[model samples]
Target chain A: MTLTHLNARGEAHMVDVADKQETRREARARGSVHMQAATLALLSEGGLPKGDVLATARIAGIQAAKRTHELIPLCHALALSKVTIEFTLDEAESCVHVEAFCRLNGRTGVEMEALTAVSVACLTLYDMCKAVDKGMTIDGVRLEEKRGGRSGDWSREPMPEPAAATSRDPSAEAEKPAEAEKSAAISPTSGVKIQFLAELRERFETAECVLEWARLPSRDIAGVKLALINQDPKYKALLNQRVLCARNEAMSQNEAAVAPGDEIAFFPPVTGG
Target chain B: MKIVINVQQDAFNTEVEQARLTEGRSDIGAIVSFTGWVRDFNERPDVSALTLEHFPGMTEKALHVIAREAGERWALQGATIIHRVGRLEPGDAIVLVMTASAHRRAAFEACDFIMDYLKTRAPFWKKEHTDSGSYWVSERQSDREAASRWEHS
Candidate 1:
């Protein structure tokens, strides 16, 4: 184990990379922003109110790569040769995947720069969409591969399967109690399915189910919101501001009513663009 | 006016910085200092760590310009800005801004002004590590608003 930034007195200091030989170094990192399907549609269709989400995120990522040293205290400032940020819009999984690559002829590895680019790009995506979907999550940010430096090249083991796709389905992973199955029982008439996504999933664990309100509570967005809060007061504060409610995968305001067979999803403001 | 800017990867000594600003200074009357630390929680709870990055040569240059601007805007005996880069945990000092002046207002305003400019103008990015994953911190609208107050003046 080596702590490069510590001196004889164990005080923190910048490591002197001045004596190290300059070599071509490259690194790749990846992360993703999970969101609602409707939000994904808005991003892909260029309908986000904040303008081009992908374009803005890409620029943010590239800019972050060049400024890595200024953000990380101990990093050596090197002139980066190239930086690239790419986004994969996976509609089926309801997420935007980000990957960044950084290259330079310098004494230090560019892994941190690459990781920073991916991180910023993901954050920019969240910022652009937060007003509409609050619960978007940024996850799995890691250095996928790196080349050059004294230790040589390294790469992460191949994942058994893409985690992004499976992570979107909270119901599959969450332990369901008898109460959840009872709530999931669909009535012959006037019943609707309710699901919570992202941050809401953690808050309303096993709260998702099918319900039949005699009056079809979804008649106004407020009715559904109140009902959910009534079911669990813990959800009241979250619903009041940061969380957004949706009907059948489309953005719905509190005034909008729910219809039978409709799917209701409650989520927080999306932070990923 | 005396200006000092340091960009490093290790932790800094606040007492040393305070002493440096007041050393051999009989003309100074008031000294103001501000230190920022990484918060354990931002937007979400369970933040495990934070990693900071920056542009080396350019970051130092930008900080110098910001310090000079503070000096020009206020009457001061000395000022210091020390920003740490690299991986930091919660409660670790991320930045230090200190100012000394004959009066408290100049030292106070200058210190506040420097931080406002530093947040938006500095070549730095921060990533928060949480239990579930890590995220890059979004530039806050509040930070922009704070920086913009100095635009007209």
Candidate 2:
């Protein structure tokens, strides 16, 4: 793709959209301000020394979205139909998820405006909370989705690390739980469904196995692992690595309680987003 | 109040689902809906498609629990959640959440709450396919953080 803002001589210039058709276009963007969890708590509770953190940030983002053309010199000034800013307080991640939506019936897309809104909102948050948390980081400012442009619509995909994606095969066919018949055969009577995922599935050469509770010497996770290792020496690798365990569907520890009907799953620390 | 949940591989019509929630009703003055779409790019560029994996039984169980939680916390007339599995292309609708109530606040908050819980608590995992290759999506720390905010709410 050629750069629209540069001429044949490579000098920065604005591309005229005089002949382009105006369509209803919308853009969504996201950003975040990472801070200490304690700082996030204070901001949420209105304990910040700076009064009304979110209110100030909200207004700032709206203003920024409207005046985006002024900030970016080459951007065309257009009347925006709508601009909205939203914030999600994530305590576990110690950050605030900021989202912005900008819409207009115009020749150019509103992606820059949406991105500017999110960026300003995150910066505003950091400005308000910096007194209490100096280490706050403004990050992940990017376009999420844009619709109604010549390119049609584009969205940001949810993805994992590129290195991991290229190095491994996570295709669906490879992930089908080892034959359902195999698991069924192992536990004709009372049994626990023992499933493997991701790397474990490839390494163990089985997606899942059902072990009869009565056949096992014990029923806890440790005992089940031992049984699998005894049944096939390859399963012994599970014990040496930092594999995760889930009972039913919830992550569990080795000593977590187990019963005949429980479903047990083993895998590497999840790479799912 | 009525609750409906679907985990499938089929595409859904937003207007059709919204009509179902407010069908034969005048008491519902507000209906809030959120739709999640598969995007073409993410941390890396040139993402062609996405594959979603889920634990068959647990995925349904988790959606039910999340819906029940929303029902318990809100004054609502109806709530419906639909999530799609399998391969999806850019611009495909992946999830739909709708909440209807007599007023806006309840419907809006409940819809937001359900999405927050679903992002972190759902059993589904995403694998992104790019021009370069494909890889399993990793859980986001921000997602876990977003879900945690509702624990005390």
RMSD of each: 24.7, 22.3
Model 1 chain A weakest lDDT span, ten residues long: A159-168
lDDT of 2 by residue, B4-74 (tens): 88888899999999988888999998999999998898856888998877777767777876876786677
Kindly list the per-residue Cα lDDT of model 2 for residues A1-273, writing each as its tens digit: 356788999999998899999999988888999999889766755667888888899999999999999999999887999998888777679899998989999999898999999999898998999898889989888876676766664444233223322222344223322332344346444587899876678678899898876455444688788888888899888796567777877666664445656789987643322
Q: For model 1, how does the per-residue alpha-carbon lDDT over A178-231 read when each residue is reduced to its tens digit?
A: 323343354443466777654556556754876555333324567676676677
Model 1 spans with C-alpha error above 4 angstroms:
A159-273, B1-153
How far in Å is the alpha carbon of B50 misplaced in model 2?
0.8
Q: Against the native chain B, what TM-score does each candidate's chain B reach?
A: 0.97, 0.96
State the DockQ, from 0 to 1, for candidate 1: 0.01
Candidate 1 positional error at A71, Å: 1.2
User: Global CA lDDT of candidate 2, please?
Assistant: 0.78
Clashing pairs in 2: A92-B145, A93-B145, A155-B40, A156-B41, A157-B41, A271-B137, A271-B138, A272-B138, A272-B139
TM-score of each candidate structure, all chains considered together: 0.38, 0.51
